[model samples]
Each structure stands twice: as C-alpha cells, then as structure tokens.
Target: MQSSLPPPSRGRGRATRERSTVPRSVSAHQEAVRSLLQAPLSAAGPAAELPLARARGLVLARDVTAPVSLPPFANSQMDGFAVRSADLAAGRPLPVAEPVPAGADPGPLRPGWAAPVMTGAKMPAGADAVVPVERADPPRFPDASAAAEVLLPQTAPGTYVREPGSDIAAGARALPAGTVLGPAQLGLLAALGLTTAPVRDAPAPRVLLVATGDEVVAPGTALPEGKIFDANGTILHAALAEAGVEVVDGGLVPDDPGVLRQLIREYAPSVDLVLTTGGVSMGAYEVVRQAMADQPVDFLSVAMQPGGPQGIGTVDGTAFLGFPGNPVSALVSFEMFLRPALSELRGLPQPRPVVRARLAERTDSPPNKHQVRRGVYAEGTVRLVGGPGSHLVSALAASNALVHIPEGRGAVEAGEDVTAWLL
Candidate 1:
C-alpha cells in the first residue's frame, strides 16, 4: 500500500510527528534543477537578428540604440501659420508666404512674413511659433495670389513645435537587454525604422512526455474493465504548451519496467528534458521508480499534499522530472515547481502572481504536509472549491487560485489571512 506518512525532510534525517517531513522546500527544488542543468536544452543557437514582426515574446539580447533623434528635425504640431514670435508680439497682421503642406520642404520663412504650415510639416527656417488656424481672424488659408495678411496673437518661442530629439535622443539606448518584446516594444522598433531586433537564441524547450500504467487508456476510446482514460498526458501537454515549452509525445507505457526503460532511452536523445507522470510512488505497479532504480535518480516523497511523490534525475544525459499520477496532483506539481524553473530559463516571468486574502471558511491540513487547495478567490476572500482529494479534476477546473497552507499548521479559522497563487 502507498505510505500515508510524509517523507523525510530533504536535509534533515527522519520525519517526526512534531516536525514536518518536507524533502525540499518549493524553492529548493527549483534551485536544484537550475544548478544541475548545464545548458538550456531547447536553445536553438546564438543570438541573432530577427524581424520586428517575429520578435514578439522574445527577450532582447542586446541594447537597441536610436539611429536618429525622434522627430528628427523641428516640425509643426498644428495646421497654422508659422511666424517669428518677435513679429507677433504685439498682435499684428503679417504677409502670408507660400503654404508649407506636410511632406513639402518650403523655402525659409521670409522676414516679416507668415507661412501656412500643416501639422507634422517641417518648420520653415526663422519660424519659432505657430498660430492655430482657429486662432486666426478668418480661420482659413489665404490665397497665394492675393498675398493676404492675417492678424495673430502674441506667441512664445517653441510653441506647437516638436523639437528634434524630444521623444528619444540620437545614439541613446531605446531598449535595454533582457527586455521582453511586446506590443509597445515592437511599436517603438517600428517607429525607429528598425527592420530587425537582436533577441536571445533560446528556443522553446522541447520535452519528451511519457504516461505510465497498464490500467490507463487513451480517451475517446472504448473503456475496458478497471481502466481509466489517460488524463495526465493530456493535462501535461496542455500545461507545457501554455508555458511556451514544446512537447514530443511518447504515448502511454505499461507497468513493465523493461519497456519503460527502452522508451526513455529512445526519446532521451532528441529532447532537452523528459517528463513522466505516474509510477513513482510506493505502489506495486510503480514501473518508473523500479526502472530508474539503478540510475542516478532519487525517488522521494515531498512534504506537500496532492503531489508528495516526486523524482528529479538525469537519464543518459537528459534531465527527467517525475510527477504524481493523480490529475490535480500532476497539474499542481507542474505549477509549483516546473513552471517557475522553466519560465525563468525561457526569460519569462517567475513566481506566478501571488496575493493575500481572507479565508471564507475553516479548513483542515495534515500535521506534516503543506496543502495546496484549489479555491475561488474574489472580493478579498478565498473559498475552497472542493475537498482535499487529489483526483477532483472538476473542482480544479472550477478554481482560479491555489490556497496554500503551511506545513505543521493543522487548521486555519474562517476570516484568517492566507496566501493564494493566482492561476
């Protein structure tokens, strides 16, 4: 029978009734993987330039310097007359010169004259102020043949003029290294006229996924006696995809240890990591544990409920992570341990969003196990969705957060503060 007792603490000896037997803290397990993995398994190559359109969600490997100042030259910000501020100091009518439409380079402003400059047009030389069309007496462009003059109000220098380098300075850093390219970042690159950006060469990590157990069968197929659909494989594949990792399905392996070993050997060379669900716990059909018994892997129970049985080791130079078979346990294990580590390696955000909230009702936890309970968190309160069973796939789906109860703290009262991980 599977042991109900918690495993021994990682660094400490045996587990006692008073002390929790957590083999590793959530952080410790993540750190171990970081230290053990020498190179990123999914790396494509060295950093190289990528088109701006294809750079979204990629990290910038180098700083991007502005080739030219934003608004490269002085331009007009309003469709109005560009006049020397000194000439309009006393609100006097000035002769209108040739109109400067956007994209046209009109001659420099004639002394004692106004030039009709459209918005976004380059400011004519010797012009420092703009009088909006509405602010003019007739509020309309004068005829060039008529050589009309219009009255203007006193104006200050630099008004309505977009000065050179106002948005970004030339040769200045537009984006620093390690910036994750998003809409705003891509827009900036496009505005700067850059066709490509230097991004990290890391490709999405490739994983070989294996599901074990003779009693498990594929979904949408006929159900034989004492058989369950293979939920773990589907759940894990979806989770991996959502995390930006690539998965190569190894299909379902039966309880035979020799066949499991042969399957691992076949896929290990092509993948960066190997992830297997089921057969790592203290059960008669624990094929994964028995097959890897002679290898360097360590199969141990963590002091965490729903996902206590865990394994981390390398098989033929490929790292392998073993997760519990229960649907909820498998999903929670990925969220708590594998997700954070993989995200960090992929230059994505770490430690999924966590928030504090009050408990909606009383809850019980095992004496020496940290319990991750699925719950619906809203309006500053978190309510448990279902019982503490690890097979409650329906309840897990209904939850939007995971409420964490620390080990050795048996029960929590209603209205008490608790930590929750947002999904």
Candidate 2:
C-alpha cells in the first residue's frame, strides 16, 4: 500500500506567496540576479608550503597565529642610559658602567651605575629608566672605555624601553580567515613571521561565448549588404574577463539550429556556463531558441528595451544564458545578470558601484520598458552619446555609463536624476 496523507489543512493557503505576472523591468531582472546569487560558495582549502606570491586576491581559509611575541624581548626604544629609577635622586648624575648595543642581550643592570644603551638593545636587568644620550652632558664613558664622565639626570621607570609583547602578544591571531590578501594583510602576516598562508582557491568559472547571427561579421572583415561587424562578442568577452571568468570564445555561429545544438552539446560539459547572443527572440530565423528547445530553457521577455529578450536554463548541469544580439543590450544583460551572479558565487564585495547623474539634454523613449541609454558621465553631468538606439556603435564607443530610466516613464527632461551604471 502507498503511504497516503490526510486532507489538506486550511493554513496551506499561507504556505505559498502569490506570484506576480507583471513584466519585470531591467531593474527587476538585476534584482532577481542579485537575489539568486546570494548563496555562499566554497572557499579555498588549506595547504602546507603555500606560495603567498601566487595567492594574490585570494581569501584566507584559516587564521594565522603569531608564533612569537612582537619585539620578542624587552629592549631599549632609544639610545639612552639604562638605570634603576630608584637610584634617581632629586638632583644628581648617575655613574655610567656598561654600554649595550642592539642585538646583544645586556646582562643584569650593574648596581649603583647606569648602562649606555643604543636603540633596540635589550634593557639590562633591573633597569628602570633611560636617560637619552643627548641629555647626558660630556657623555658618560666608564673608566678606560672613554674619557668624558657621563652625567645623567634623574629618570623614571619604564622610560624608552620597548616592553615584551608590546606590538602583539605571543599566540595571538595575526589575521582572521576569509581575509582577501591585500598589501596590508600580507605585511601584517609577514610581521607575524608567517612565510606561508592558507588561502582559498579562486574558482575560475569556464565560460563558452557564442555570438550568433547571419548578419554579424568579424571586425576588419569585408562587410556585405545588411551585415554588420560583431560588437557583442568583444564587449561581453571583456566584461567576462574582468570578472575573472575563463572564456572559450566560440565566436559567431550562423543562424543554423543543427550547428548551434551540436556546439552546445559539445561545449557544455567543459564549461560551467554557455553564453549565447541573438536568435532567442520571436524572429523567424531564431536558431538558438529552436536548438535549445530540447533542453530546459526559460525564455523571458524582460521589460527592458533593446535587451528585453533573454534565455536562462541548465543543460546537463551546465548553465546557459542567452542575451540579445545588440551590443548595448548584451552588455547591459551581463551587467544586470551575469556580473552580479558571478560576483556572488566568487565572493566579491560588490559587482559594481552605481552612481546617480542627471541627463545633459532631453530625450524620449518608450514608457513601458526600462531603457538603458548609453552616455558619458562628466563634470557632474551625463551627456547622451547618441540616440537611444542599441545598434549605434559610435555612441557606445563614446559611452562610459548606462543610464537606467525606469518603466512608466517617457521623456526625461534635462537635469533629471537618473541611475547610471558605470562601464
């Protein structure tokens, strides 16, 4: 007999939140990406003989304990006479006995006499105070060692002596785990006498990039009618590279489902993610969407102009994200989705810092879709690089930011506040 449960409970209605069917804008897409990537990732494992030189930008996997106390000894902090403060009177110069230099542990302080000490020298036993060398007149040189008798003024205990464990106590933690190895952290660890550190391995995700279109040709190649040089490939490639991703760079794939499917199947296992451009929309010759039909693909018409079409899914445990064919759209999709996703999985602070700027002039756009208009932000103002068209390469070349204008908004007047994502 099959195990059967009782009837449903009345409170089950509260178990699930109502799903909103409203089209998600570009901001919403970015928010979804931000939320989905909030899960923690595995950190690097510990190892002996770790090469710190090769661990730049890696997070520490374990705490670094101090093997020895900082300063490691009670030493002199200044070149002065080491003396017992008890010997100091209201008005008097103490007699100088032995001279102590750095690196040599001076024996116990000679009774009734002060010792001339150099900076970093271990304080003689029972030494209470240090009279700076300059403070002594004629400089005190004990019998036969030097001529002038050094006269030191009365001094106080604990003066000019570096106490043991003053910098860091022995067995103290030098640096905590999960610290991104920076110059300061490295220096601190070195100061703690750590020649090696345990750091997490940086998981560099292998990615396959495919730019698809019959009209897209390689740059510097002869252009035929109705064909343009591919810009999305280079743009997305650079973005992925900066984010520490390894790209296969499959280049352009003609609008052929057979080739696309074969490429997807062949490259999926080797790469952690497959990124494709174009051929996912409602266009008649859309090959990527057709080819991916056999796989788990989520076709989304995100409420964003220029880059509203997108596809995301998993094929045999390898993820695939399909972006629009336009250069600006592809880049915006990366900035909105993949960048933040990878940053989360890779344990970065934040993908990129977004700034707010004003439009330098008036511009009109669709009210239903959030538009990503390319522009240059300068002098506390943002000037549109060109018209709000995604195919304008010249405009994109001049742009350093993508200004996000929200949906249900039409013409943006000059000097209006707009959220800008830096490129």
Candidate 3:
C-alpha cells in the first residue's frame, strides 16, 4: 500500500514526486517507532518463572546454571556386565553376582564377581569398566540365585561407562540470558534436571489491524470493475501474529472516513496499538488523513522506497501507525519500521537474519531515498526479484531476502556488497 507521496520510482516505474521538505531518514523514523512501542511494552510487566512447556519461544530473563551435573552418577551406556579391569585375569570365569535393572543401585561390585547392568543403570562402586552382554562368555544374565559364571574379555578402564559431568558440569552456566528457548534449548534444561525456567514475560498485546480503501475488497469475492482483492489485511495479520500479537481484524474499510473512524472507536480502547494500511497520503481520497484530521496523527513522508508515506501518533487516545496501501509497500514498512520495534519489546519468532552479500547483477536506485528490493540471495550473491514498483506484490512473495540499498547510493554494479535481511 503505497501512499500518493511515494519515493522516486526506480527501474521501469514513474518519475519521482516533488516533496515539500526532505523526508525523514529510515533510521530516524525507526527510532521514532521504538519510542512509540515503549509505552505498551513496559505495561507488559516483569519476569516469569514458567514450566518448560510454556517457556518455548520466550527469551530467557536470567542465566540458568546447571543444578546437577548431566549424567549425575556414573551410569552404563550399554547393557553390559559391570567388571573391574583387575578382575579380568586371563579371561577367567567369574560368578555372576546379580542383575542391575535401570533404577535399582547395585551396591559395590564384589571382588571377582560380575554384575549384569542394563543401559542407563547407575554403575556399581569399585567397578572401573564394563564388558557388554554380547561379549561376555555365555552372553546372557542368569538368575541371582543360580550359580552362573561368566568370562569377560580384557578391556580398558572406563569402557562402556558414562562419567559424571561429561555432558555438562554442575554449577556451569548452561544457557545464558537473552537466549530464545526453543525445543532443543528446553531439552538442555531438562537434561540439567530443571522443571522451570525464568523468562521475560511479555503479554500478547492486542492490535486493531485496519485495511482501508474503496478499491480493495476481501479475498474469495469477485472483484468489481476497478477493484482488487485486499492484500494488506492478510499481510498485516500474518505479520502481527508472527510477532505474537492478538490481532483484531477490522476487515475491509471503504474510503469513507466516517466508517474507518467508527471501526477505530469500536476497537481502539481494547487494543494496545491501532495499525492501518492505506489512505494516509495527501491524495484527495486519503480516508485515514480525513478521519484523523481532528486526532493527533503526524502524517509525514519517509525517505524509503516501496513505502514512503508514513503516519505515527495517537488516534482517539490509542497509539497508531499508518502504512501505504500498496501490498509490497505495506510489507516493506512492517519489515523496516515495525518488526524490529516489536521484536525488541517481545522477543518472539526471532529477528531477521541479516547478511552482506554481493550483487548478482547491476541495479539502479533513487538518489536520496532508502530502497528495499526483494531478492533471491544464494551462495554469496543476491539477485533482484522485480522492478522497484511498490505494487509488485507477487514479486514480493517470490523473494527470500530484502536487499537494502542505503540512501546516497545511486547505481550499484555487480559484485558490490549490500546488506540483505533474510526473510
């Protein structure tokens, strides 16, 4: 959703529009968005001690030290006979003392006696090695009362033994603060015998997502003449949900200012943020500007391509942000200005992996505006996806990275390095 006041259209698009003043830099507007999110994020409250099941996808609030060593005691790594290296003299037959099942502790191994231990069973005292059940002569464990003698091959010390603290030592920092707990990370905690973890408690904030404009209609419906299916709503809803937001979809709002205002009024009080796409530019039918004329919304032009028209401030006492109506523009606006801010507030879904890659082909960009071109970054190079048109929604879908062409760089040659945010 591109506003009427868009950046200079590069690569097969229209010429640049004249502006009243130099637009704000992308970094400057990013700082502004950060400031905007602080209020809602702070209201989310403090740290929480959560069970492992509920801690996944949440950032760790504090470092977790191992309370107990992994493999706390010496345990058998295989089903074997617990034997002392000194006991295996010339492969002599030794009487089987007893069988140790998984949990029961076999007291110390008697001298010249063999104890059959199951896998994961704790080893007995005075036993420095183990001979597997297959290798021991007779190859089977007899009853504890039956007198069955076994012969064990000569083996090295600590054979088939799981030494204490081999995986991780006690009191060691297993996971540090700010680590996002996933299944693997939680498994590590479980291995350390922890039932719970301390994580940064971030509430799922409610967001009112508004998709405006008369030309836009919901998907699955036949588009009338001069109308298209709404992409902004779907795009924004998925992005919000990915960041762990409780999205209240406002549906398709026509170009009527009254209708949009009523929708905002109905949902704004219940939500932490009011996010809208479409109708923010200075065009004649800019319904967002029309609706928020009396409200405290600062509609301004940002120095960024695909999405340039920006609006930030409050509407009816609710924090708000308005993006352009073009589908690609809306997505770019989110990735650039909104996503990072939300991630900072509630660390979920993780941040975009950023990398520097060489350009796969020569490309042109606007003189002073920041540009985000959808690209396919493979190996060590990135190739542009589509021309620099905000309306190229299909092209955006095919991209795996957003190649960032910073302000002041005009024409870039092949092999030149550029920053790309992996999608």
> Top model by TM-score, which number?
3
> Distance from true position, residue 244, model 3, in Å?
1.1
Quote each prediction's TM-score: 0.75, 0.65, 0.81
Give Cα-based local distance difference scores for all models.
0.83, 0.75, 0.85
Candidate 1 residue-wise lDDT, 32-109, digit = tens: 555444365435357889998888888898899999889888899999999999998666688888899899987789
lDDT of 1: 0.83
lDDT of 2 by residue, 1-423 (tens): 001111212211111111225555554455444433333223333443466676666667778888989888888888878888777774566566768888897789877677888888888888977888777775534554663346667777788888989988899887786566778887777777777788766567788999999999999999999998999899999999988788898988999999988888899888878889998777889877888876767667777777888776665556777888888788878876788767756655465667888889998878988777888998678888887776787888888887877777889999998877777
Task: Report backbone clashes per prediction.
Answer: 0, 3, 6
Cand. 1 TM to true fold = 0.75
RMSD of 2: 9.2
Model 3: ten consecutive residues of lowest lDDT: 10-19
Model 1 regions lying over 4 Å from their true place: 1-22, 39-45, 53-56, 73-166, 223-226, 346-351, 354-367, 375-388, 398-400, 408-422
Residue 178 deviation, candidate 2, in Å? Answer: 5.0
